[model samples]
Target: MKPTAPRYDAVIMGGGLAGLTLALQLRQRFDDLSVLVLERRAHPVPHAAHKVGESSVEIGAHYFDTVLGLKPHFENEQLRKFGFRFFFSEGRRDIDGVTEIGASRYLSVPSYQIDRGILENYLAQEAARHGVHFADDAFVRRIELAEDGATHHRLQWTQGGETRDTEARWLIDACGRAGLLKRKLGLAQPNDHDANAVWFRIGECITIDHWSDDEAWRARCDPQARWLSTNHLVGAGYWVWLIPLASGSHSVGIVADQKLHPLATIDTFDKAMAWFATYQPRLYEALDGKRHLLQDFAFLRHFSYGCKQVFSDRRWALTGEAGLFLDPFYSPGSDFIAIGNTYITDLIAHDRRGRSIEARAQLYDQIYHSFYESTLALYQDQYPLFGDPEVLPVKVIWDYAYYWGVLSQIFFQGRLTDLALLGSVRDELQHCQRLNLAVQALLRAWSGASEKRNRAAMLDQAAMPWFAELNRSLNDRLDDAAFKARIRASTAQLRQLAGEILARARDCDPALEAVALEALLAHPEYRGAQRLSAAPQHDGAMLFAVPAG
Candidate 1:
């Protein structure tokens, strides 16, 4: 007779960040729940260079710190991010002589620059401590998802050179690009945002502070910790990322639009160095001396993708990169992970309580995909405008407002599954989405028609009061009435910002038409708010001193 398979309430596949976190969340929410995490790689993975998602934004950070109760780990083991910093340096050696866009000081809310290896290792340990069954060095042999909701999903795997079988009420795929369930269910889809990326980790720090000799330029940022930020060296059609890890290493990568910078040009270390020499001479010079310190090199073509389905009534789901991935421009990888994991956990809870999750599954799927689509607007065709210092600065402001004002508001208020509140504020959320789409189109148009200013100046995000406050306001605890009112106000803020952006673009080129934005603002609902200016002035003064121009 065949041996009986062990059964669990939840069996999460590929116990990396997403899987491990889901296990912990489930165990945390329901102490009696039995959960197992099967990861392919062994535990205690090498630090600094093990993986690429080394940066966390507001949503991801909050999910890890607050939702999962791992704040202490982040505080002690990871690096607190100095916020995102950018330099429009292309074919330029003078790092301080380019258009800079970033905060002059850290914002009120916190994010972290995570070393994936360290975080994952720590997550594994934490999951075990929290009573989660974690199986490292496990290779999944096959998955047999139940066709009916009443039956358990069966998963087959190998560990210690022996095959094992288990049945689970909830089977989650957090396997990263492997898409174990996604591929089996024929759910893979393609997105039109064709881009490529090549990333590697350096064993030593690629400190930007030493790049410039100007004391004043160095003094622009408080604490003089530019090296602590996720710095982007941007140019036409491409941007290079510099993310610091806690384990005394730096992560670097080049993301480019395939149309302009072909993957072949910088697919290898030598090729990347040569390509960087021409477009990013300063960064190239920084890396040229650290060739021996290269910890890992990897590249992916057409990295952005979509999924036909992630949540299902059949009691199986896909989380993290297994579902879909947009660009890494804003480090949204972990944000999506937080979102998917939350939905999965909720679905499991509903099933455990004998509640019908069929309709809720479909609704949550739609909402999650809507979030993905809204964020995709920020990166889809926006790469072409990255080099336009003026337009990009304004675009960054709009993007952050849309983020902090809408989605981040909902998440921070602990309302991810608040279907009632979300339904009540449906109109506002949809309007916010429309405004973002229009603003993105307007930004692209503005970039095309403007002079594409690359002059040396700092567009200080911290100096903008509304921008800083919007970020700080994420920590506010709100009741239902307050949350609804906040959503309405946030919608109005987006409209006001849209109007200001449209006006600014028209100031540059009066002929530029922003029909969608104009039409949205013309709506009776948006008629009366005082237009709030969220961007800094064009003059290069006040926030920080520019080189004695």
Candidate 2:
């Protein structure tokens, strides 16, 4: 007689960030919940050269630290990011002579530079300790779904040369781009932002602060900590990123718009170096100095993509790279994973309680899709603006404001699964979403003709009171009503700022077309009297200063 297979509450495919985190979440929420994580890769993935999502932002950080109760691990095992730093030094070598946008000190909110191998290994261990069945080196051959909603999903995989079978009430695809479920369902959707990336890891730190021996320049920052940030070397159609790892290695990548910077231009290590030699000469010189320390190199063409559906009432879902992926410009990979996993967890919780999950799942799916669409608009047609000194800073400020003001507040407030709360703020949230879409369009239009003065001054975000205050607010613990009021005020502030931005765009050139955005902010109270401005003419004048030689 054949042996009987084990049945589990959840079987998550692809034991990367999404799968492992989900397993941990399920086990944490419900004690003794039978969960299985199937990972094709064996245990102990390589350290620094493992995977690409080495950078984490606010939401992902909160998920890993607060929600998952892994704060100690983050502080001890990983490097705290010093916030994002950008240098508009395209085709230039002198780092001092460029418009810089970054903080002089660490931001109040904490993020991290993760070594995927180390983090995943720790996560797997945590899963096992929590009683999750984490099967490494598992080669999944078949995923057969039940046609009737009452039956459980079944799958078969090989582990250590022995075939194993299992049945799961809920099946999740966290398989990255392999998209086992998505491919079978034909849900893969092509997006407009076609970008390519080439990345490698070096067994060393590439500190930007050390590049210039000018003591005056180094002293501009409070602690002179440039290497601790995710630094971007910007150009017209591409940007090179330098992310440091806790393992004493540095992750470098060249992400470019396919139409502007062809994949063949930077397809291989040699070609990438040459391409950097022309577009980002400073990075080339830095890499040239440490060529012998190069550990690994890889590339992917047209990386940005979309999916038709992710969450469903059928007890199956897609999270992370298994469903959709947008551009990696702002390091949103892990952020989206945090978001998607939350929805899946909520739906599973609803199902386990014998509550009706169809309505909740559909609503969650809509909310998740809306988030994807809004974020996608930011990078879809904005690559050319990546190097614009004047426009890019304003864009960055606007983007950061919206992120912290709205989405970050929701996550920080622990409202991801609060359908009732979301329903109550339906009108406000919808208006905010509309404002975001309009602002993205307005920024793209503004960036088209905005002049790049290429002023060589360091714009210290720390000096700007409002900007710094926003960063500080991330740590504030607010009550329900207070959080709602906070979000409302933030949206109002953003609306005024968008109007001022449009005014400046008109000031630069009278012919720009932004009728819709203008209409949204066409009230008389937004007139000549006084509204906040980040420019030098306003109280924000002291934000940027030139370093003495």
Candidate 3:
């Protein structure tokens, strides 16, 4: 079905975080732009907890607070705050014999946890407040793209037991892993290497608060606890997450590689629960004989992918998971939604009245694609061996510090788009790709001393040079203070570098990197690394200075 004319400036498919956020941002940026969000599910009631990504790290929060200026509203509605925490069995001997590390909690002016459903509801209400229209319980039957090169899109949807059609100059796909629009456009692709996830919410379980006083037990909760205000269980090949809601209930589920356990073999929810019970005792213990399950378990495969093209000859663009996804280890899923909203709003606002829109769309595609690829590479390298016991603790600690101290701060403050960090992240991604190739070569040449020696030497050379460069970069970035003050300012940078290095270093020397991170973070001059000041006059930069005697 074709419409009489393009009825909307943009049509957003999917009402999840990504779609709703994009709608809100569009409304915020352009008052005259007619926006319509097509959501499959009925509009959820206020405070209803929806199943989706719950964790929001510093970077994610930054996107919401600084990039989109949505934090104030979120805080008013009860979003949770989080800090950084990591636990590992493999890297315990590095940081004073502690396997787990934590950073001080920080909020985005105002931050707290809210039901994703509630958040979406608020965004929808706000969108309406800004003159954006939302059509709920409307299923998109098909999307037809015109071949005339005008880049127009025709949408077919069912509402009120009647067929309806709508036209839009721009299309935004925020449909999540389903890739509704991508499939309609023949752009859906699989993420072959990633693990599958099957998760559900369960109730009346023993919460993390049950053991909060026990530092040892609480440390294993993973950082998501702080962000989502829940406890989680992590293990090799799979992980379990527990998110607390205002209703005193919890969201719990397991994610794993389907190849390891064929999906066909497990047909029932009981079977799925049993499978999780076998691998995750803690989760099972919490849910043992608990009240009825809240929701049926669900599975997601190929949760990561980017549209071949984000924009079209028309004004269409992809946002959120509709655009791309990486590993969830760092909770980049929700963050991308916020980021896409901001970027798209900027592009639309700055676009000329009637000039070539394709160029702007193409630029959006290119930039987002680059960012997606780079972030994906980072997770691919870091997540696999992050749990290896032979690894050192230094890198993990420092990595958290850097994420908390700098990268996260910059991201939430909307300053990541600038500075050398973006370039650095890109460079690090390329370097990791090379390292992966080298490691694979060594694995294939197993049992040959020549190959072994070559691999070792290459690794060793790779280690020292990059580590030294990282240290130098961090040191140089800090205010030219005395050794002590410089150490304080660079603590986050030092820890981040050490974490990256130690993660890839030989097990025997993991502590070497760990000790370095510890020394920097716990240096005498910087008793509380969190208190380090932001570099004056440098928007998003930070600087450390030595105190005069």
Per-model C-alpha RMSD? 3.1, 3.3, 9.9
Residue 70 CA displacement from its true place in model 1, Å: 0.9
> lDDT, candidate 1, residue 428?
83
List the candidate numbers ranked by lDDT, top first.
1, 2, 3
* Top-down TM-score ranking: 1, 2, 3
> lDDT for each of the candidates?
0.89, 0.85, 0.52
TM-score head-to-head 2 vs 3, winner: 2
TM-score list, all predictions: 0.96, 0.95, 0.71
Per lDDT, the best of the predicted structures is: 1
lDDT of 2 at 528: 39
In Å, residue 319's CA in model 3 sits off its true spot by: 1.5
List runs of model 3 lying over 4 Å from the truth.
1-6, 45-49, 84-99, 104-112, 146-152, 212-230, 259-268, 291-293, 357-359, 381-386, 389-504, 507-549
**How many clashes show up per model?**
1, 0, 12
lDDT of 2 at 391: 80
Worst 10 residues of 1 by lDDT: 535-544
TM-score of 1: 0.96
lDDT of 1 by residue, 137-158 (tens): 9998988777743478887899
